[model samples]
Target: MLDIVKQWAWYDWVMLFIRLISCFSITATTIQMEDYLTLPLWVVVFWEIIVFSVPWICLMLSYRYYLIAEMLLFGGLSLYLTSMFPEAYLTLLTPAFLIAANSAEKSYRWSAPITIVFLPLLIVLFSREIDVFEIFPQIGLAYVLGFAFHLLIVNHRQNEIIRKQNSVLEQYLTQIERVTLLEERDRLSKDLHDTMGHSYVSIIMGLETLRPDVASQEGTEKLDSLLQLARKGMKEVRGYLHQMGSPQDTLPLVHSLRQLGEEFQTHAKVNVRFRAIGEEYPVGKQVKMTLFRCLQESLTNAVRHGQATDIVVSLYFEPQQTRLEVQDNGHGMENWKDGFGITTMKERAAHLQGRVSVYSERGEGTIITCFVPRLVESADEIIRLFIVDDHSFIRESLRTILEGQRDLRVVGMAEDGAQAVELCEELEPDLVLMDLEMPNMDGIAATKRIKEKWPGIRVLVLSTFQDTEKAKEIMRSGADGYLLKSIESRELAETIRLVHRGGTMIAQDLLHKMLDAQSANEQEELLDAPNISEKDENSYGLTKREREILQMLSQGMRYKTIASKLYLSDGTVRNYASALYDKLGVRNRDEALQKGKKEGLL
Candidate 1:
């Protein structure tokens, strides 16, 4: 009975209590004064018992049966009780009926409203027979209580449902996290085996060649080979570190193409050559990745579908645009309707604002060419910049150098982070060249505040020190780029222009030093903290692509440039940036970068 009551809604319980009270009140009235109702005492007792049981029966039954039963039982009882005993408290049954029907139905769509209207009409009809004040107020209060209880029960059930759904969602999310961790573990193990295994083998082979007492040419050659192997091993390890942190730090287009070529040669057993046709030029990361994907997808099709034995990937770096051609000596298809791979290839090309052309015939080899237009800031695109540094000479020097350019303007200057943030709000400049160390507030805090207010504002960090920790800190803070104080004026101007155009430029020397220092510290930490896994060390909950964007933004690249480089739309990039900021618990880029570095995400 208690379990059944527990299943009942609040209104059901209240209606049960009301029926019980009505039954007792009527019984007491009948016993104290048999003349009160002008009906037989036996009939009154039976009616009161019947009325008392109606709400309980209604609550226990299913919706369809409960509705029919409640109406018949309450309607018959109300007509009889009111007709026989006009002054009886049988009038209370009206509110109870309304509550029970609605509660049992799991909705108050019509029952409660109709009951309200019926009650007033009933009071009007029985105005002289019924005590106007007593019956009206009792019915009114009963209706109010019933409706309120019904509302409470509905809200309670909704809350319970929501809680249950939330629990299920949480469990799903937990499972997803576990899956992600497992995948990450698999990836890390593969990277470690591929990168470190080769280095260790080379080192071991070189060590085997060493002879303590030998002074022959063979021994000298062996020693030199050992030294070379050691150097190569160090380079490989550095490359691995870059992969863990920022791919753009070292994984350029040429490197990626070569890596892809090697992979094809190893797996497909095909002779592949990745050739560069022009002088090397800095292309956007988006263009590079797109070209890489184009090569990858085309090469895959050639090997799997086309059964190609040899392939040539040509990368053409033109003055205005970049072009990639994947030519394979494979079996050409007769009817070449775009399938999933071809469609995806076209989509990737289109995403870069590039066009893809597939030329294939039955006997002749297939050639896939993709041409992506490079985004270069035109002469008319002048970028407004603000400089914030404590040293008057540095600020003046930067302003003089930048303002001299036709496409650059120094809109404001500040000596501290506070001033920088305040001036940024007022000026709303396109870019801000900030110094990490300053009075009133530091660049880190200022960048965070400024970015929180104006997310679009790009911040470039200029510092004298090459401290990896500071660089990581500033990068984490959301600075788009970092530069050393020792930078040449011309180089500084070019870097500013590059960053303004949505390209990233970390002073190469600073990056190398930071990487080296970081690698060493990581080695030491690895030895000291052997239990720390890759995910545990750097799980700020960001994807590889997001970290890439964050790395670029830390180097002071703008959204448009990042989008172009990433081969994403401005809106997509903005959404990613916004999501990144949220995950890092920041409102702007600076804080995100700062938080990322602190959390080891950088």
Candidate 2:
């Protein structure tokens, strides 16, 4: 009813073989009547070879289904006809058995119509038999039964083979999905590590600028402790994602350009007080990317080859354009021959329609200036915001950023978390900018208070420390969000709104920390243990860039250091430390230094 005849399975082939053997065996049993079947013997021998031989030839020639049909046709015909001439040709039973064997298979469809037309011939053959119905009727029945047995074998084998193939295919597909998932996760890790690493360094540096505000002797000790803690965090961060490091965002344009004469003064250096002409605005993404790279190349050259400690970084930002000049009192490049670092720097400059000029001589300092336009657009009006930092400079700086936005208006500002807490009571603005380590009251204490008092108001954490768990704990205290101040200003601004709107924010390294999804102790013992934090990065004899890298890695820095230190974005500084790690024969910084001392690298 459902046309199952066309849906025949491979089991039919087994039926064909069984039928052939059975019919052939039937004729062998009639050997005693050989003389009685003498006439039929010649016909049986001649056609037996023709029927079996032709089908085999067709099979060998690749007519697989055609051969199946032929086998069915000849088997059926010989069985019917030879039964009438039983004594005449007993051997004909063998061919009849062959045809019946495969008759159930779909391949025998062609034989179906032919067998119908041959029914008349079948009647004629049966008519010659005396009492044919009574004698040997079970002979044909046995042939059919053997074919059924063959069909069962075929069905079983074919089903087993198909089931095995399906299993293999499913496994292959699952493997592909796992690979894709891993690749996506890696990509996200690189992004968070790169963008947030530089941001953390800058935040730490900015926090260092607030050391003067710490009033008490106990506070000073805490400040020093905090400073060490912060630097250690930075060092550890460099270890993991050292390759994906973004160009040092630590030097906010103004810091890199001027007022740094005394910071590195212990090292003996000249100063360049290059200041902006008017109100200096932050550069664009493309320009920021270029300036970062150019400065990196200059810094690398200064630290590595510039013997003269008198180095000056001058940056002048005007409304229309921004100019960066890095001057040093050291031997400069003698020839135009460039290495990969310098070439890379040049390529980045070209991307922004900018140019870089270098003037250098032996025993003389070098001056590298990269000039690019400071294209300004009116700030977007995204959301209203407020900031509370113990450091006046930080509060003022963040306030300026929020105030600059046409849409965002700072309702109020506070110097300490205490004042912020009080302000939250009165102002009750949309969001609260809670600095983690604040004077009088810390962000954690203030957040606990605010959440208890005004749970609706969101607290966005701004901190330099790598103790992200501290942030997590603060979030547990009802703080709505957390962010390291070193993050891109735009990202910071965006994260605030997202958090205020009920979204959680995390530092880039948080993902790396969570990558294993195991406890800290378990992570250390994991198979193929992924390098996590940088240990003893400060004690390591790494130069500034390398030290910066170690700090990032130790703090769970991902492979975005290339983007941080070198200013390459997207796929920039990935895999930079893999070979370095191998050469050091150490898995991480602590081991690298221990080994380095053995090799006199210390």
Candidate 3:
């Protein structure tokens, strides 16, 4: 009963109040006529209480059959009392209104019949003492009013439901928009890092090398100026990347931390020591950022706030969690409180289900420790790489650079395409970093043969050529990614990992050229097949999947590459291609492409 009352609307409370008042008035009026009653007045009052309380309780409990019984009892009592005392008919008006209202609220079909049956009884009872014409309209008005009230309540409840649903949908849309913005920001950051950041670093390195070779002082000074400008640009890029929350995908966690410590030692002129207590392991991007930020904050505070001369940073890797501690030998704070940096550090740690704590004393140094659950990558998650280039120098250089990374293992090296194919058969590396324009068999042919035999092995093209035609050919030959030889070493390693993980990487400029060529070809096909009507186009009845397969085939993509791009199995791609061939009435892929072009379906 309490739970039901808690759920009641204001109108329900009002109805309960009115029903109780009417029950009390009826009881009081019956008590005043005690002289005419056969039974004792107290018994009559008790019986009246039971009659009203039972029906109201049934209504609260939603007992619809008992409500019907209550209606019958009320009608019999009103008729019997009216025969005994005619004035009692007047007091029954409130109970009649309640019955009509509740019945209509439950169901209008039942309410209509119930109201009709009660109307004649009301008229017959009232006619004995008063004119039927005078009271008939009032009785009808009560039923009408009750039905109208039911309609109002239902309308209000529906509106409330719609309002609540709209609120939830708006909140959902806002969350989606926020997520999309973050994704776009991350993508922009990566693009800037891969393109502008790499270019700037290469420029700085080139300038540094040229500085020693310059014979004239003027030339040396010019190179120095250029190097400074390049360094400044790189710094700005790094700051922008930090603002965008870019992940350090290229370097391992330990290397990144060591690099950070080295930078602070060089720039701040403060002694910063870093040590790894346990066996080093890979951690997730969030954990890396949290630890990096905590170290950065601790170093800055030690120099600027604590006036520290030396800082020691320790990283502990455990089975369950990872811990980072930063201690500074400087005058500590007598009273410590969280500022913006410490608060942000705590929030970042908390986001990873971790924590950050600071311990400080007046004379002793301060120690800031962060504890984060270890989200370690598998130890065996290494990319077994094969290098294929005609030049021995290129092959050995790539091997040295890639082998320096913890996750990359150079398993084999091949001089030319022919040797690469033979060695691949025996060695079966996870990825092949193939160089285009090789002697005898080129990279494109070798890639095709390898994909035909081992469709799972990824092939990434590393070449000097940015020719659109060659890129298209290599893609069609089933190469998973393409990169320029001028790409930064770190970017190259990251791209290799990305490709090995079923992602495609292409140089931005080359990708733009390929897209432009594709658009031109599409326009030319449309112009040539101007007479192809919409009905004829629909006649092919190609499904969305079939159309996708056909378009990729037109671009010379092999079955395995198409399957990888679409996240489907090679056998499923073959089935779709076969269906497309039959629908086009073609014997092979070349015919399908030609027919598709003529029909303007590419």
Candidate 4:
């Protein structure tokens, strides 16, 4: 009862006021008409008070107690009052229909039959005072109409709740986003500080090491090296800015890969080639980003440690998958070792439900290949849609529009959350357009249950409310998308199609709000996650020599150099490296290197 009052909005208050006024008007008319039973005036007043005040007080009680009070008052006292004075009919609308609607909304399956049974008794008792046939239809019509009005008011109040919640969420998201951006900028500034400090220290040390031989070739060469270090430090600052300023979408995928190859070629002073096989196909944004990062990391490893003079990056497209391979004509090791880079590549590939493999030999080049699955459109398959909303008009509108498309079909519909679950379980529709507010259950709870039972069934929230918190809650509940009722028909269709193809769709305005909220949350989680300790080789499932080999490789040491340092034959070193690769679950040096850095092994 308290929760209901707390959730109440302006529409509820207005309805309450209107109901009170109408009840008062009917009582006044009864008093003016001087219509009374043979009972005394005080007795009449007692019954009238019981009829009006009891139901009002009942609202404050729990549902079970309230129903008991309502039944005793309305089924007994209300019926008697109406039987004696039919004029009570006008006043009964407020409390009687209100209770009935409340029961229908709160306990639809449990209370409905009882209410239906008692309703006829009330009408039959009223027949003694008035023409039963003449008034029955009128009273029934009024009850139905009142129930409809209650549903509308309830929906309006729900929208009010959503608006209030969204307001709070939007403010929080904006503030968090601001804080996150400031922190990121601070981190970048700190990195720049460290770089500049190191460069300045190097310059100072070179100056201090110089003697009166400042005019000598060695002194001149030292000054030149200092100048070069300063220039390189400045270039590092520019690189950070370029990365921060340019969004990934600004560069086409192929163009970006080519540019990545070209930049590495310029820096590493190696011949690098980029190639694409088969037609360029559509891939998800996350998949594209992963591939790009993998390529960048691979090139860095090839030139930095592979001793490669020539490199090749290739992208191959198939009907249902995209494959990327990076090959380097470098003096490869006798056996492949897993490093931080290689582990990182594998992790990135796994994000797209993909896998990575590596091929290398003692002197021959190394090739790293990653395969990622892509969603493919099939001409023969039809996209099934399920509509779940309390409003018939909304459901009908969606069903009509969706059914008109040849590739899309409305497989089922439900009026509320409980029905939606049952229908979805039986029909197993591909997509569900669910409304947030309903009679028995709500969209959030239903979405969670549906996803848990049938994870393949994608749920898209179709709500009149655009609450950011509610949107996040629904997404957390495993909904694929969220949309507002104000969406145009064409945009709605496109969004459905996108979601059906394993893409997420959020209303543009809500999308921006959610992005702000999610960005802050993601950054916070990223910062909060535990980092791998460099010395904890056992914790990371690595042997001592494996850790040592990884550290040396990170320093750009070759296999022979590492073997000499460790006082082991090159072949023995290779065996230990291969064992590390298996332990790390990585195929190549680049992935291993990436994984090592991620796990703090380097």
Candidate 5:
């Protein structure tokens, strides 16, 4: 009953008020007419109180059956009173309207027919003393108003449901956008690492090889300058890759803010203090970003404009909003206008239905407070991984790369596949990254055992081999993905996520090689059989373009040379060669040649 009262809306309170007034008036009238009653006056008054109190108790307890019973009893009481004193009809109007409205709201089908029959019967009872025409219209109007109120309540509930659904849809869209942005960042990072990093390394190596060959002083000086430039470029590429792979994108609001403060303190050579108040709560990415930018801008202004040496950053997580307060101990401005940075911060907070306030004096430094409305949680489940590799350096490097991702955690590492299988049983990691060329119990055997025991766990093979047979074997052992050690760090991280999401991710080049091997094996088997027909000659499924590429490969023609002769691009020729390999069931050009000679196609 108390819980129901706590959840009552304004309409419920209004109904309660109306119910109270009607009960009091009816009881008061009963007292005034006690002398005309046949039963004892006290007995009638007590019965009246009990009858009125039942509806209130029913409403509170949400007992619909009892409330319906009370309605029937009240109707009988009203009919009895009208018989003794027709003037009692005036006191009955409010109670009749209340019953009709409450009943209709509960169920129109049950209440509508009841109201139509009961209200008119009451009117017919009053028709002896009052005109039937006047009372009938009044009763009709009450029933109409009660039905209208029911309609309004239904419409309000539907609107609430739609509003909640929209809120959920918006959150889903925001999450999708965030994931897409992170994937694009990783793609860009991988491209830079593969292209620019390789080019710089090559340039540095060639320059170092020619350094001793330079005889003149000027030539040596030039060579030395080139070496320095190449090294600098390589260093910059490494920095960019690190920045792109940073955990800032996935850190919680509090951790990200603390990191920002520490970075600011280190670079500005200023003393900084950080503190948080209230229980922390998860917030959306946009809200976090808004607060982050506000703190960043405040720190900059404190140093540049206020010349503040010491700074204090305070974060408050309240029920309604998340707040940030940045105060400095430097000189402050008495009459400061809104600069571009301050305006931008205000706009960002305002976009999230929040606000930014600034307070500054001549000597008290500046205080900037930003408030953003609390949003949805941004935490995701972490994926545990086990690494199986032989080299210590490779194991540590893999750990570092995987740990940089917010959702990925390297829980265990092993030097060989045997150790990996043992630790995996104990750790029960979500995913395993294994190398095929391990010393004891190679990756293929370990993978097979793991899948047999725990089919829920995913296995990804990260090896140096481009060997098609090994890839097929590991895959048959139930590895979810296969890739080479030459894969970019960013790509490796993304692939781990994809595989964890129940996707199979095979390296593109490895897939091409596997297809080539399968095609060659099939063609060789077909050609070795007897009773060969004209269709058997083309059983490899090679097109004219593919056949030409295969013949060029037989003549020791480079892809570039073949493309030039065939009036095709280098990429087109390579695609033709891949197709040719696929049709011949071969892994490489050499395999294709061996099969072609035995079949007399070359």
Candidate 6:
């Protein structure tokens, strides 16, 4: 009841009043004059109800701007009816015209007063027995007062309806604002997971990968300091998980650079140092963090590609902006291919509305600098994660594990191979745990296909199939590994470590497969699947994507089903099949299938 009233609009009240008045007056009119079938109440009732009800209904519909037609219609109807009804039935016109004209309460004020003054003249004209001036004026004045009072009450009711509508609008606006905030939080969290969260993880990983003894004593202290910073980052992530908003602070840029210098010195055989050139002040936390990431990414590049003996870190701060530089003395940039670390560094710099520079000489060194603009960083980011598995328990379990990792969060869950593939592609998980034998794209097939497209990705096939055939098939298909799905919690960590180690894991089973193969070599290996050449594509005059479609069509997947698999529209899929059929000199799915099979296109 409250919800309905809350949704009711200003016009609804006037319409309701008009309806009530109309209902009463019409019923009274029916009693007064026995004209039921001939009377034109349909137009009046429909107009009144719609004019009142539609406005309220519009209020209920979000994103619907106000429509002006209802008002114009009601006003036009009132004017027409007023002109015609005055001559035919004055009593009915009095109420009907008043209710219809009641659309504009403001107009009633002026029109009602004028009509009051003119009423005496009207009565004199209409009545024969009534006195021309004295009695008519008295009756007109009484009618005017009563009509004005009714109009005033109706106008007041309109205002109350408006007030109530405003109250509801306020609540709705608040809900919308909250939803917006949550959505914003979700967006920021995704940014962090892919950006800042990954940043910190790399920082910690770099720090841990470093050996303390490999660096100088001073460098050791600096590396220790970096570890402490990582711990501080963990705390911040924890505070967010606890829903506690904290004052975000940036560690000194010098501290982060020094830490990186020592870490690089230990991790790689590089002599690295931090040097400050200009005057420094407390730059904003966001700026400092951006600078830190800049240094970390630069160092990662240097270690990964440049076999350097020394690297220099410099900072120059001014009123408008700050400059961060990491120069490496390494094999240099001439032959250095594109790396993720460099891309991330450049991307992060751009995200900060800043510019990054990379200058390198073949023999001298690679120099990287970033200029950061001023932007206040959001303190809280809500992470969203999605996990896919055949079991709900596995999804929940993975969620628990991921959530346990500081700064790692999960947003959604999915069950089964198909859903897993869907969510993996949709969420683009940092890691995908593939389970072997489930409906819709078996683990082996999904892993191979996903890796073929995205090679740098990490996928660990968690399967109960301990068979060497499974292992051989999986790895050959470019899967990261085939692990016993029921790996103990203790063993899981090591397996993950192997996975993220940037290579496939060769367990005892895999080793046995390798050794057995070495002992009894088979020429036609189970691992090697026949690859279709461009010669085959040209022979068939169909692309691999087209061939795959033709094969599915041969297997009898409807256009809709094909569209779902290929992530294309049904029309697009039909067009592809149509083209394929045309190419094969055949019409329809079956002929295409038979031709495809004959040509080995399938």
Best by TM-score: 3
RMSD of each: 24.0, 28.1, 18.6, 33.1, 22.9, 27.0
> How far off is residue 483 in model 2, in Å?
1.2
**Candidate 4 structure quality by residue, lDDT tens digits, 1-602:** 67558656675576567546755665565566555655565565566566556666666565566666665665564465566666555444454466555554456454444444455456566656656565555555555765677688778767754654454345334534643564455445444544564355456455556645589787788777776776676677657644653254456678767876776666555678999988886565446656876887677667555766689899998777889899998777776766877876765564344667888887797888888776544569799999999867668878888777767889889999999999887888999999998999999999988977976787889886568999888876778778877554655776676677655656645765775786687557545645535345444556456778988888888876775566433434555566567677778788889888887677
Tens-place lDDT digits, model 5, residues 296-375: 77887787678777899999999867999999987999876667688667656644446678889998898999986553
Candidate 2, residue 185: Cα displacement in angstroms equals: 16
* After superposition, candidate 5 runs with Cα above 4 Å error: 39-53, 60-67, 90-92, 104-106, 119-134, 201-223, 242-460, 463-602
What is candidate 6's CA lDDT for residue 264? 50
Q: Which 10-residue window in model 1 sums to the lowest lDDT? A: 241-250
**C-alpha lDDT of all candidate models, in order:** 0.66, 0.55, 0.73, 0.68, 0.72, 0.55
- Candidates 2 and 6 compared: the better one by TM-score is 2
Q: Could you tell which candidate, 3 or 4, scores higher by TM-score? A: 3
The best candidate in terms of lDDT: 3
**How badly does each model clash, as a count of residue pairs?**
16, 56, 0, 18, 7, 5
Q: Taking the tens digit of each residue's C-alpha lDDT, what string does model 2 give over 161-248?
A: 5654454334334433643454445444455554665556567777787788988899889878887887787677656544433333
Cα deviation in Å at residue 441, candidate 6? 20
lDDT of 2: 0.55
Model 4, global lDDT: 0.68
- Against the correct fold, how does model 4 do in TM-score? 0.37
Model 2, position 495, has a per-residue lDDT of: 57
List residue ranges in candidate 1 displaced over 4 A.
Answer: 1-320, 324-375, 485-602
**Candidate 1 colliding pairs, count:** 16
Model 1 C-alpha lDDT per residue in residues 1-602, reported as the tens digit of each score: 66557557565666566667766776786667777556788887886676557555655655555555555555455555565467544454554445533554444555554455564456446534776666656666666776666667778877865654454345434534643454454345345644474356556555655656568988879777877777787678656644554343246677777776776566555679888888777665445656766777777777666767689999888887788899988789775645556655654554444567778897688999988766554687888899999877668878987787777889999999888877887898988998988989998899878766875777778876656777777666666678766554555666666566544446544665665776687667556865444763454445455677888998899987886575343544665675466446577887887786776665
